[model samples]
Target chain A: MTTLALPTTEEEIWRYSRIDELDLGAYSPQRCATQVVGDPAILVKSSGSNVLKHDDVFTQTNRDNSEAIVIRVPKSHAGGAVEIIHHFDTSGALYCPRVIIEAAENSEVSVVERFVSADGVKALVIPVLEVHAAQAARVSYLAVNELGATTWMIAHQEAEGERDSNLNLSVVALGGDYARVRTECRLIGQGASAQQVALYFADGTQMHDFRTTQEHVAPRTHSDLLFKGAVAGKSKSVYTGLIKIHPHARGSEAYQTNRNLTLSEGAWAESVPNLDIETNEVKCSHASTVGPIDDDQRFYLESRGIEPATAERLVVLGFFNEVLERLPNKVLATELYDRVVAKLAASETVGSE
Target chain B: MSVLEIRNLRASVAGKEILTGMNLTVRSGEVHAIMGPNGAGKSTFSAVLMGKRGYEVTSGSVELDGVDLLAMPTWQRAVAGLHLVMQYPTEVPGVHVDELIEQAWRTRGRSTTELADAVVAEAERINFDARLVQRAVNVDLSGGEKKRNETMQLALLKPKFAILDELDSGLDVDALRDCARRVEDATNEDSLGAIVVTHYARLLEDLKPDFVHILVKGRIVESGGPELADRLEADGYAAFSG
Candidate 1:
């Protein structure tokens, strides 16, 4: 069994990441249960065995070791939440799952992938996913991390949209010891649009890292990305994204925004956004902010009779409302908000030792 | 009993003295109009009363119905029935106006369903656009609408003692009249004690304040009836501060 070398933090693509700390030799590959909690018939269709091109260690390792599940949505099947929960119970082992979702032409679908583990289960999970949105199809996928504190995950997602297609990708990162996800989105057809939104919160020495790319390959394509995270309890978060417009992709519009809130003085977050435009006819902009929650908003809420602790929680939840409102699944958004509020209550006291 | 009483109040911010030995008293079912010139510490007094940070109450005793108010946190003060219609309402981007009021009343043990009803009913009674309650708290609201929203909140919460710190500053004639009527109705219903802080006499005239005080240099230099505000409308704070 040949193993790929682990990425080091010195690598620019993995800069400020915990990749160097991962010891691939410590664990061996194992297959986790990928149960379709919903009707499998609606999601178990195949779009043929389309190969994904990627050399990343986690992606290759998953492809070689894990079973691949290709979920197919029939043409014009507009309403299906294809919810899949990956359960990993093996301790001191490596679990990997690969999911491939193909939305047929003019079909709308929502694929929810959640990673879960029991408490005290120590493992490393690597998942690779590919999403193909066909012409005029609409697809929304959400990945939620609910791993235990003893686990870690490094995942990658590659998504491409066809002509006039729409794709929305969202993430809620609230668990695991150290989790990193790289999302790459390509608008492969003219009039295609894609939105990438994520909400991540790290506490109690946990870490979350994200790398995203928005590639506009066709003219008149548009992409918008918003990622928000909060860190507390000496935890850390890193976000680096790129919006790339090809030379012939004229009249393309891309906007990227990343905002982070540091609830404790010890907590830290870093945001870096880049734009690579080869044509002057493109409209592209990126904005990034990493700071503590505004005292004005806090005081305003406090003055309105909300307890300080409760006020902080509400503000933190409200901070993510902009992104949550974009979710196609309202029930998932509300449940995710409750989970975030619980995470915030743990670190509500900003200065308390 | 005094609904609110500030005894020998002295406060400061950033090492600068603002409220120096100020004293005031209010009882339920009474409206006290406080007229002060610019730099007279009107806003600071409101901040201090609300327990807003950075305003150090150097030496003072604030009692809300005999409860030691200074010891409570800002939110607790509101829960204890002390409300302020801020001059400049803070803009909370993602919090809707209805959510703001509903959350505040929630702290007072009000059920969400009850408070939601109150928010809608009170907004209607104040003639506030029901659509405004759907918007973010004070974000992109017109000045008049903001004041009306605060008045709408005042009606919903129905605090025991309310402070209108220049609530009339940004309102037009009709907005001023509308807000005044809402405040008046809330006071009559709750038997609320209120302190109207302003630089102009228009709001006081609309509300028909029972007692008017000319506050100069952080101290109440004179206290009388509606006639006092009428006189100050003509004389200005220069008559008392000088």
Candidate 2:
């Protein structure tokens, strides 16, 4: 089996990212042996017909890859959140684990995938998720990346939306050494819709980069993307999104928006939104904004007797709530909100000094 | 007896003074109306009372039952029994109206079951459709709908001291009357007082206030009984300015 070489800075995708800081030579790809410990509330196994058994994409990719894990969700199950915890205890190398989710027609499901390492373990992890939303199905996906401070992570999500299906994906990044995420979704059938939302907070010289694409190839399709993030402590984030509407995809509506809040003078954010629309009847727009939090909104919350820290948390939560609340599951929405708040609180405590 | 007392309260925004030495006393069970021309600092007074940031408090003090209001943050002030129905209520997109109202209620120490029941009953009293509770706060709402939503919040919160900043603006006559009636019904003899800020005197016709003060150039230029609204309607701010 041929091993896949780690990407270098010379690659276009890794240009602005700090890929050189990752020393893969010192580590070897090893399967996680630690007993994953977390409540079902925080982690759970997926239940459904194992679609990965018949056509496992990760099996084919893992021959030379270092990480491989399979998750299967069958059709027509009452949608609920499934949490998977990836624990890295010892310092070593890890390959991308493939997660596969299949939603049947009229079924609804939500999953929260969390990547966390053992305290102080300097590790490398690569994770990939593939989601298939069947015709008329609904799926909500959330990923929380909270690896060890010294660890490096590379993640990707590839999704396909079927006819009249609905797909929603959200990512929250709060830890890692150098993290990169590539998310892509294709609307392959008429009346399918996809929504992408992400929130990332980086600090302590860490770097986060995200690349996303929403390709609309079917007529009457819809897609919307909203990713908001904050950077502090000299950390940096780069977000690039593309919305493609094919020539025959008339009557389609698509929008892409990226908003970043920089809290420190040295913190930086780069946003690039691209649109390729070939149909005149389609309604499409892309917008990106990178700046500090709205002083007015912050002050408004503060004036309500909320302390500065509490006010900032509320504002940040509110900022992301614009997307979080859109999730179909109230329980999942509240859970995500609380987790994001906890992350913000943790950062504030660390930065207080 | 006085729930809120404002003495010589002066404020500014972007270096321009808006409220200059404004003095007012609101006792429990009293409804006061501050009617004035455009740019008379009516909204500015409400903003300052709520501790809206960026509005520099140059001088004077505002007290809620003798607690220095300027020292309190907006949410604390809210928790201290102060609620403001903004002239232009801001939209909190993707936030359900019920969730916000419930949060405010819970923050004020109401039990979850009690809050839910109270919210549902109050929402019904204001003729709010049950479906609206699930919608984003003030998103895609009409002028009258926004005003009613503010009243819904006031009913749910039931604060001791309330400020209605231009709450009568942009309402049709029926909606205006409905809003005024709701305000009258909501404010009672129980340690509850309100300061209604508006430019139109017609709103006061249905729910007569105990006192009327004409504000001009950041100061109370005229003070009188409910008749002051009628007098101003005939002569306008011309009689009170300067």
Candidate 3:
């Protein structure tokens, strides 16, 4: 294997990000030979034994050498959820994993992937996932990142939708030293639709960054994006999204929203939503808000005999509930709700202590 | 015995005094309606009882069945049998109506099996579809449906003392009639006491309260039997406000 060098600030995507702070020289790539162990409920495994591929596009600019792990779902297969679990336990190292999902025509599937790191390990991980939805197909994907506090993570997700196909993607980030996620969806076929939802919570000294793009290249397509996040302690987060409608993509409807709740004065959040519509008869709107919890709303809950801490928890959960309710799967929605509530509870406990 | 007693209660929000030395007493097995004009501190009174934040209780002593109600948290008050049917109940999205009611029921120490049975029975009484049980609480529900949902919550919680704040405001005629009957049935079945706050007598026509008190400018201006509702309906709150 040849050593690949990481990119610097000169690259357009790497600009405005602190990519040079990461030292990948001492980190070595190792195959994930160890079998995964955890509660099956939270783990996601591939359907068949397939040779997985790993690539680092930032280090190796050669797209030819980049390998892609493909998981195909047949059109006749019944639609259900698939879970993918990635566990990293290495110390003082960098890890990169690439994944690809292909949904056949008229099929429907949901994939949930979890990224976790062992305790006491200091590592950097950059993961890239690609998804292709064939004509009239439907695909829903969720990524949950829960790494150790000493770990740094940067992930990218690119999806392409075909004629009359639907794609829904969600990301939940709860742990990391400095985590950044970039997700893009391209509607390449007429009548295709895409929905994107993201929920993130950062506390202590954590920093989370998110950037997304919804590109409409065909006519009569639709897209909706909602990204909500909360910050506490001395944490910081940033969200930047773009909705681009091409000249030929007339009659496209697109909406983007980013809302942030700051729980502590020391915490900070920044949101930027942009739209570029080149054609007539296109409807596009973007909204971004960053503020603390509404005092009146919190008071209303507390007055109902809910304690201050519990009231805050309920309000925060209610804030995210608007987005979570949009998820199609009730069971998965409940599970995600529980996980977010647990995060809030842990923070409340720590704040109180 | 006195289920709730409020003495010289004075509360404020954002440094503005709203509840000015108000006083009230509610006994078990009795229904008291607090009628007032808009901004007479009726809603503020309910907020104060729920221990809502931001409303500073400048001076007051609230006791519930010999226990200090003011000292307990809001949920604790619910556990202690204090329920409030808010005028505008918050839409708790992503939470199923059944799940929320069940959680509230279990929080009151009811067994899971009992809670489930109670929810089903209450839903049936309100003519609520079994399918609505799985839907998010109050989200995208019609005004009438939201009111029924509130009543459903009241039935499930079975609070010993409840305060309904203008529950009839957004209800239609049929919904009002149904809600009134449900209230009558709930009170009769559990011998529960309640403070029914409203501006009109239509809701009280069927559920004839044991007493009706006219609340004016944060004070009870007049207290009488069911006839008071009829009188207020004819005369209106104008004369009472003066």
Candidate 4:
């Protein structure tokens, strides 16, 4: 096996990241079974991830020593929903869990992946998920990160859409000391489309980072992204996204937006949005904003006899409602909404001061 | 009976004084109309009374039932039975009208279940579009719909004093009459006092007022019965300007 060096903050892709603080020596790879709850016939032990590239040290490491599983939906079949839960309980351990979802031609499927850890456990979790949508297929994937306060997670999610295929990707991150997700979605066929949404809240020294790319490589492809987050206490967050339309991808449309709310004096947020269009007939737009709760919105609610804290909570919830409506599954959307409310209630005292 | 007394109310915006010793007293079940020209401190007065930020009360006292109103925050003032129907009601996205009203009603120690029924009943009484309650508050609504939304809140919340600030600015003849009639019904049924701020006598025709006051240079320059509004309507504020 070849020894590869870990990535540092000096790399352009790792800019504004806390990668330099990671210590590879403190962790050793451990094996754990990922619980898959769904149609048993759909699960198959796969050799490795075929949809993702091993261009980075993390991906290579995961490929080197991970038990890969694939959930395959038969052609023209509708796989209602599947649940995959990963639980970490060992301290000072490294976990590399790989999952690949395959939707055959004209098939439809939905999956919910959750990562959780036992309280007070300190570990590093590197999770990789790949989605392959064939022609005229539809796929929806949702990821929920609920690791322990001391745990660290670096997740990679990649998806490819074929002709007339549709993909919906969503994430709700509310845990881990430092959680980062890198998402790359490519529309490689004509008339393909992708929609991405994320909601994250960080408090009590937590940090959440997101990097995304929406690449349109075929004619008449479309992609839209919306990521909203809030930082309270002494926590922080970062969101950087890019919309890239290839030269041959004429008649493509893409939009990227990232909005953040700084809820406390000590909390902070950073947002950067970029667009690269090499084609003439393509339409693209990118927008980002980092600020505090809108005073007018707060006043509007408070003036109606709602208390200050309750008003703040309501405004924050309202801010996330747009994203919530687009979530693919109704049951999980309701659960995530309640989690947001609980998170706001937990940080109310920190925010008020 | 409830009383809203504004005594020697002095306020400023960005260090520039707008209200110079303004005084007014409103009692329950009474309607007072304040007519003024543009930039005569009409909106500033409402902002100061509602404790909206950025309006500094340099020296003044607003008393509600002999209790200091300036000391409480805006929500507490709402709980103390003070409401303002804004000239341009703000649009709150992703927050439904019924959701906001229900939560606001519950905050005042009222039953949540009853609020839903009351909202439906109030919307019907005012001829308000019942469908709007399910949509975001004032989002994508026309100017007349916004005014009707505010009037619906006024009738349901039932505050002791309701300040109708430019309530007729964007209303048509029919919409103006509907909103004004709702306010009149509130005053008669709930004994709600009101301070109507407008530039013309059109709204006064639908909602009759017991007194009419001409505001100039931040103070009441003339006060009389409803005849003052009719006379001012025939003529302009040339005689009232200092």
TM-scores vs. true structure, each candidate: 0.90, 0.81, 0.85, 0.96
Task: Give the clash count for each candidate.
Answer: 0, 11, 10, 0
Give one digit per residue, the lDDT tens place, for model 3 in A109-133: 7777778886567877777777888
> What TM value does model 4 have?
0.96
TM-score of 1: 0.90
RMSD of candidates 1 onward, in order:
3.0, 5.4, 5.0, 1.9
Best by lDDT: 4
Task: Give the distance in Å from residue B216's predicted Cα in candidate 3 to where it truly belongs.
Answer: 2.0
Docking class of 2: acceptable
Relative to the unseen true structure, what is the C-alpha lDDT of residue B232 in candidate 4, on a scale of 0 to 100? 94
- Model 2 residue B221 lDDT score: 90
Cα lDDT for residue A83, model 3?
A: 65
- lDDT (0-100) at residue A348 of candidate 2? 73
Worst 10 residues of 4 chain A by lDDT: A46-55
- The C-alpha stretches of model 2 lying farther than 4 A from their native spots are A1-12, A32-63, A66-86, A99-114, A129-146, A160-174, A188-192, A201-206, A231-235, A261-268, A291-309, A326-337, B64-67, B79-81, B93-113, B129-136
**lDDT of each residue in A1-353, candidate 2, tens digit only:** 43455667686556677767766566677775423332233222543232222122223334346333333444666645566676766677665555667776777777777787755787777676778888888888878787767787877678888899999988878788778788888898899999998878788787889988898989999999888888877889999888988887889999998988887788899988888888899998888999877776555444333456655665666677776666555776687678777766776776777
lDDT of 4 by residue, B1-242 (tens): 89999999999999999999888999999999999999999999988888899999999899999999999999999999999899989888778899888888888888887877888898888888888999888889999999999999988888999999999988888889999999998899999999999988889999999999999988899999999998898888998897
lDDT (0-100) at residue A238 of candidate 3?
Answer: 86
Looking at model 4, the pairs that clash are none
lDDT of 4 by residue, A169-257 (tens): 99999999999999999999999999999999999999999999999999999999999999989999989898999998999999998
The residue-level lDDT of candidate 3 at A36 comes to: 33
